[model samples]
Target chain A: MDKYLNSQIAKIDTSGIRKVFDLASKIKDPVNLSIGEPDFGFIPDVAKSLHEAIDSKCYKYTNTWGLSELRVAVAAKLKMTKKSDVLPEEVLITAGASGALDLLFRVITEPRDEIIIFDPYFMFYHELPRMLGANVIVLPTTKEFWPDIEALKKNINKKTKAVIINSPNNPTGAVYPERIIKDIIDVLDPYDTLLVSDEVYEDFIYDVGHVSPLCFYENTILVSSFSKNLALTGQRVGYAAGSRGVLMAMAKLQQYTYVCAPHLAQVAALQNLNLDISNYVSEYKERRDLIYDMLKDTFEIQKPEGAFYIYPKVGDGEKVALKSIEKDLIVVPGQVFSKSNEYLRISYAAPKDVLIKGANILKEVADELR
Target chain B: MDKYLNSQIAKIDTSGIRKVFDLASKIKDPVNLSIGEPDFGFIPDVAKSLHEAIDSKCYKYTNTWGLSELRVAVAAKLKMTKKSDVLPEEVLITAGASGALDLLFRVITEPRDEIIIFDPYFMFYHELPRMLGANVIVLPTTKEFWPDIEALKKNINKKTKAVIINSPNNPTGAVYPERIIKDIIDVLDPYDTLLVSDEVYEDFIYDVGHVSPLCFYENTILVSSFSKNLALTGQRVGYAAGSRGVLMAMAKLQQYTYVCAPHLAQVAALQNLNLDISNYVSEYKERRDLIYDMLKDTFEIQKPEGAFYIYPKVGDGEKVALKSIEKDLIVVPGQVFSKSNEYLRISYAAPKDVLIKGANILKEVADELR
Candidate 1:
């Protein structure tokens, strides 16, 4: 039976994240910090809208692209966030931001096509293109986890099909600055490469505002979801905005792929647009400060500006991560995100008490490693 | 922007069903028979379960394989239905049956690998494998829409990676006999080919009981969904049961592809296992008889024993389908499912009155063509 499996299957093994999760599940009330979703639940108003959709009998498949009203609402939101004239026809509601990336990669990637990603990137930025038989070129970022523009300029060529950028960055919560966004787009201007901007954490910034690559490039594929902002990760609703030709192609592929996103969740996402989530953002920002302050003295780590993670440069991430589990703490090793094995990714999306408990245990474990 | 797309995009075009839908949207209260979903809405009990899932704050991601309880319940159901000892770990919940097929093809298909399917098949049966760069060898079915055993034996070889079969099939409402199901599996016994059984319409049989290919073959990947019997098409929840090795590979692929089925839908599906939906089956059986009786006189068609569709041989189906629109009727041409253009697929999944009206207009259109 294993012989029937393709070569792509051999390239993709179970992620290290799942291994961490399986270990965490065994510990009794472990201070887990490996989750990628918000700790918050659904908003009351969004829940009401979902109930109304159910009551009104919206339980059949919608248009493959999505419900017209939801697409229109998403397009309007993208126009404001991306600072581009996005039309409703250019938007596609997907199962989640993961689904959007899956569709986009399916449309553009071929065997050996080069796709560039900065170090300390999200997991799929490497896995998706590689699974589709594309060559994923990992470039070094600055010590502070910012994109190395010079390396990007040298590596990008005609074979580069797309370059994926996630901000606020995963594993390390360093949000890209507006000037850097412009510089990255300018570098790609010489090629037909697409800028795939993953803004799932757009609403989680602390100090500065979020800058979208779409603001500088019309060929950008902007993907974000209501999973974090509205806390509907289980509902699996997200949107992607891009050029009409590419989006139409994704939609046609979706007709056979996902069919459509969950209609109940699509309705909830429409209502979520009118929500004010400033309170959640404020809460996450305070949690970020708490985790950074507690761990900065024991480890060499940069202060995160956005997202709910802090990457600390610990020696032997996999060894330290495993050692931390014995102390009832769960953290992801940097090897799961990149080639590096000297950093650990600690998610601060849990309650402040959990973060404090987990941070102290992680520090004690690091001291033992030294 | 179109230049950025790969060659696979050009191989796919907008399906003809969408064209019929776009045309129907312009007519006032058109007797639409082109829809592939049930006219029924979500079961009230299932809807209540979803609301409970929402109210109880179940909006985070589940395991990629699905919630353990749902998988257990599905395994038990598969044990009873497939007459095999299916373990809980072998069942994977997906976004829908479509997502199951997508994952299966991604894990098995490679460029130039041969996948065999009977003609007048489900659209995805042809499109999904082809998109994955497989050579789709479409065999011919008998005039009564049964599998031609000789053709199946002739076309299958070592290059044949999988053979797809859909019972109570779409476009043609033929429920395959039990002996045919065994014979199909026996034919593939000599080769290492997998039998991909799509039983999405398993419950709509009016005469003989449903037979699963998994009863005879361990390599059978049996795919079904709650979308039809429970009328939760928009919820996008389904399950596939097969060998542990194949299922584990699919689950790992799903970790990157879908993450998990909508968690809310997974919870509802767990509760839905207790639901008795025999009434819905009895109602559809009546509708199937009504439409077959009305159209058999004017069109060359077989009596549909199961499913909610009647495929009638109309002279130039594309022209007749278009002409029926003027008379406020909508049907799908057979070209979308096969190479032939002489048959139209009429879905009787609508209300009794709509089915009568649509059938009347369809008969008049066929008479005019004659």
Candidate 2:
């Protein structure tokens, strides 16, 4: 039976960072900072709308493409941000951002197709393409965690099918400036390479705000989800917007896979189509500032502009994370996101008091380890 | 971009059956019997549990394998009929049966791995395998739609990685009896082949009841969903139970794909852990009896044993269905399900009055055409 199984799945096992989380979950009270989701719940009004939808029999299957209203809502949101008239056909409602990535990779990449992935990338981007028989070519970043556009230019060959760019990146938490994004697009402009822009944390930016790659690249597929922004991770609702040709392929592939996201969740999402995140942004900024105030001098860390993560330089993330665990403070090692373990990712998406207490504990551990 | 697309996806267009459905929806007041979904909604207690779950703030990501309670409930249900000590580790909650199939096929099939699917099949069975670089060998059935197990034996070889067995089948409401199921298993037992038993319509049987392949086969993955029995198609929740080795591979692959099923839907399904399907079964029986009674004399048709569909041989199903459309009575052409257009699939899963009207119109068209 084991021999009959897909070998690629066996190739992907528990990451080192996952083991840290596993050890941390065993503790009764760990000041957890490895949370991927935001501390904020759905807007109060939105949750009520979900209840109303459930009572109104929103449980029946919508169209396989998804509820027409939600698709329209996704298009509207894109128009406001991406500054493009996105038609409903260009949008495919997915299980989440993860779901969008999965379907897009399946439809676009052929076997031995080279995909350019940045180092210090989101962990999911690693094995997915390789499993689909695509060859992964890692593009390492400089110390600043910005895209080395020259390195990208050197690697973009005819075999290169797609290049993934995750801004307000998971581990690094570095929101790319407009100039840097334009440089990356300029390097990709010559090639017909597909740009997969994952902006799941679009609403979570504290400074300078978010920008759409759709503004620069015609070949870009903007993948985003309501998981972090709307606190709907568990509901598994997301969407992908791109060129009509590419999206048509993704929608066709989705029919054979996830079918569609949950009907009731789609209906509820329609009620809160516009993101109202003033309070949420303010609260997270306070937490981010509090964390930086304590550990900023201890480690070579930058003040993050977006997402609920801060990746700081540490000698050995596994060792630091292990020491932090001993003090009941759960922090993830950077090896989860990249091949290197030189940095550790700390998530400060928690309450004010908890962050204050956790920061003190984290400072003590960092000082002791250093 | 079309040239750069995965050629398999381009080959598998939106289904012809789907086109028929699209056209049928425009008719203002057709006596519809072309539905694949059950007429009943979710169990009364389950919908309440879902609302309770939402109020309790259960809308966060569950473990990728799924909620422990739902897994336990699934294993418990299997223990009753399957007579095996099924464990939660062997069960993986999926997006739906379609999702389970997608995951399983991706993992098992290498390029050109041959899969066996019986003809007059559920339309979903056709394109998926072919898209995965697997050759779909359609096992042609007898005139009565019983599986040609002898024909299946001739085809099973080293390259045959899997074979799909669906009963109380779709389109044709022929329930495979225990003896027939046993014969199918006997052919499969020789090879290290996987048996994917789609018992989604298990609760819809009208005469000879459903049997589990898990009762006979060791290498079987029993794929069933709440879509039909519980009427939660829109929710898209289902489970796959099988050998731990295969399921572990599926669970791992799911992490990069769908992530997990919706959290609220999982909680809702827990309330109706045990099947209370007698009422649903009885009502479907009445509908089945009425349709069979009316059309038995009018056409060449078998007295269907299970499921909502009744396939009767007409001169040309396309002509009969088109003529029925003129009368505002909707019945699907059997060519949608099979290569030949000799039969039209009549769904009896409608209300009493609707089925009566649809059945009478069916008789009128059949008599005049004959």
Candidate 3:
């Protein structure tokens, strides 16, 4: 019966992260940092709002586009944050940032269409377009993980349907500065290729405020989720803001796909629209400093300005990760996020003590491997 | 930008039911019978369980397969209810039954694969497979909405990848008896066509017990949801039970698609697994009787055995539905669910007074059209 499985699905293996997760589960009290979601939970106010929503019987299906009030609120929030005039119709509440990308890809991709992504990307950026029958063109980033504007310029062609930009990118934690974002957008503008900006880490930037391509590119679909910022990863609620043409197409695809974002999560988001995350940002910033300072001398690495991960240049990352795991620490290897296997992605989203212990173990492993 | 839309998504329009939903929302005091979900909300115990889950901080991602204990509970429940020796590994919790079908079709369908469905079927049974690039073969049912076993035999061929069975069906609400289910399974046994049974309405039968194809067929993927039975429609928690090979394939697809079912809903489902739904069932049963009894005199109709709907054989269903809506009543035309436009599908899952008013308005529209 396995022969009946779709060729596309059967061709892909389980994600590299899942393999590490499985290994972590088997080890006892491993200082796990392979997980992508926030280590904390939602604030009490968010839970209270959800409780009220349940009491008020908000468990029925909302509009396929999502609750009208929630959409309005999301539009307002996006407008203030992205500094773009986002209308309610331009915002679509999705199951999560992952769900948003799935819908966006389904709407835009045709067989053999080319989608360009920077190397050291979120893994799905590569897998999803391929599964949808699109060819993924991997453009290498600089050693510091900034988008290579020249590489992006050279990659565009008639078949290039879209280019993905993940600010505060996973694995590398390279938050694209405004100047880099503008340069990338300028390169793709003549081709009118769609820009998909994944900004789920928008709230966690430490050095500078976040920059979104939505403000500069009309063809951009900006995808973000509350999963990280609100610690609601399991709630599966996110939104996509884009031009009405593409967003409407996404909403229609969403009806048959996700139906709508989870009702409880949407309601929680509505109430916490004004949530202050400076405390979380500060906490993670301190951890980022702690881990980077602890490992800087031992391993050659770039200082991360956003998100909670630090990638250290270690030879045979999977080997180092495996060796580190033997000492009760879990971290993801860079090959999972890129074609290269020379670095380790250690998440600083864990507690300070866990980060401290995990960093020392990773450092020891790197030294032993050298 | 619409020119860039995927050809598959661009080819389809908004569903017929959605048009009526939009129309219904505009009118004041509309007696809406167009909803596909249970009108009531979740039971109190379910809410209490969710509250506890939130308080206990179940706000992180569960395993992509779903929460392990919930999967175990669901497998155990299926063993007793489905009367099959179901194993925990054979179950994959999904965002909803819709998500299950989406993943299932993605796993099984290749371009131009043929999927068979009985006419007067759920709208998605036609749309989802087509979106996956499969050709949908709609076989007509009897007047009472029973699968014509002879038609089943005729439709099977090398290209036929699967057959969908929705007992206690949507729109028509015909619950297949055990004998018919066994006969359908026998007809497709030779070709080994996969059976995708949507049993979301299993808990709503008024007269007879539910008979799942899973009890008799090993190649069946039984899809059911807590939406209708537990009144968690917006919660989007459901599961698929099938042979481990297919379920595993679906699980693999789920990692990139839905990621996982909403965590809070899974927690709620786990806590309320043994919820008593007899009261809600009996309430809907009475409303079903009331609508059928009232409308039988004016129009030729089949009494729905389950699933909160009745299809009256009205001429030009859309015209009747439109005329009825002017009187501030809402119902769906048959064209949404089937190729034919000769019937009206009225949901009886409303307050008794609303059902009474909607039924009378429907009768008047049918008479005026006649």
- Judge candidate 1 against the unseen true structure and give its global Cα lDDT, from 0 to 1: 0.88
TM agreement with the true structure for every prediction: 0.98, 0.96, 0.98
Model 2 agreement with the true structure over B1-370: per-residue lDDT tens digits: 4745866676564565665666677789889988778766656776788778878888678888999888988998898866857698898999988888888887787767888988898866777878877788988887667889889999999888889888888888888878888888888888978898998888887766679888678799888888777778888889899878888888888988899998888887777767587898899988889888988888888788888889999888888888888888888998787877898999887898998899888888877887
lDDT of 3 by residue, B166-255 (tens): 989888989998888999989888888898999999999999889998878989899988888888999899999887888898888788
- lDDT of candidate 3 vs native? 0.88
For model 3 the local lDDT of residue A198 reads: 93
Model 1 lDDT per residue over A1-370, tens place = 4867888876885567677767778999788898888887777888898888888888999988999999888888877766778899999999899999889989988889999999988888888889988999999999879899999999999999998899998989999998889889989987867999999988999999889988678889998888888888888889889878889888989889899999999988987786888988999999998998898988899899998889999889998888999888989999999889989999999999999899889888878877
lDDT by residue for model 1 over B145-258, one digit each (tens)? 988889999999999999999998887998899988988988999896899999999888898888988868988898889888888789899988987788888998888878
What lDDT does each candidate get? 0.88, 0.83, 0.88
DockQ-superior candidate, 1 or 2: 1
Question: For model 2, what is the alpha-carbon lDDT of residue A30?
Answer: 77
- Provide the lowest-lDDT 10-residue window in model 1 chain A: A13-22
The lDDT-based order of candidates, best leading, equals: 1, 3, 2
Q: Classify candidate 3 by CAPRI docking class.
A: medium
DockQ of each: 0.76, 0.65, 0.75
Weakest 10 consecutive residues of candidate 2 chain B by summed lDDT: B10-19
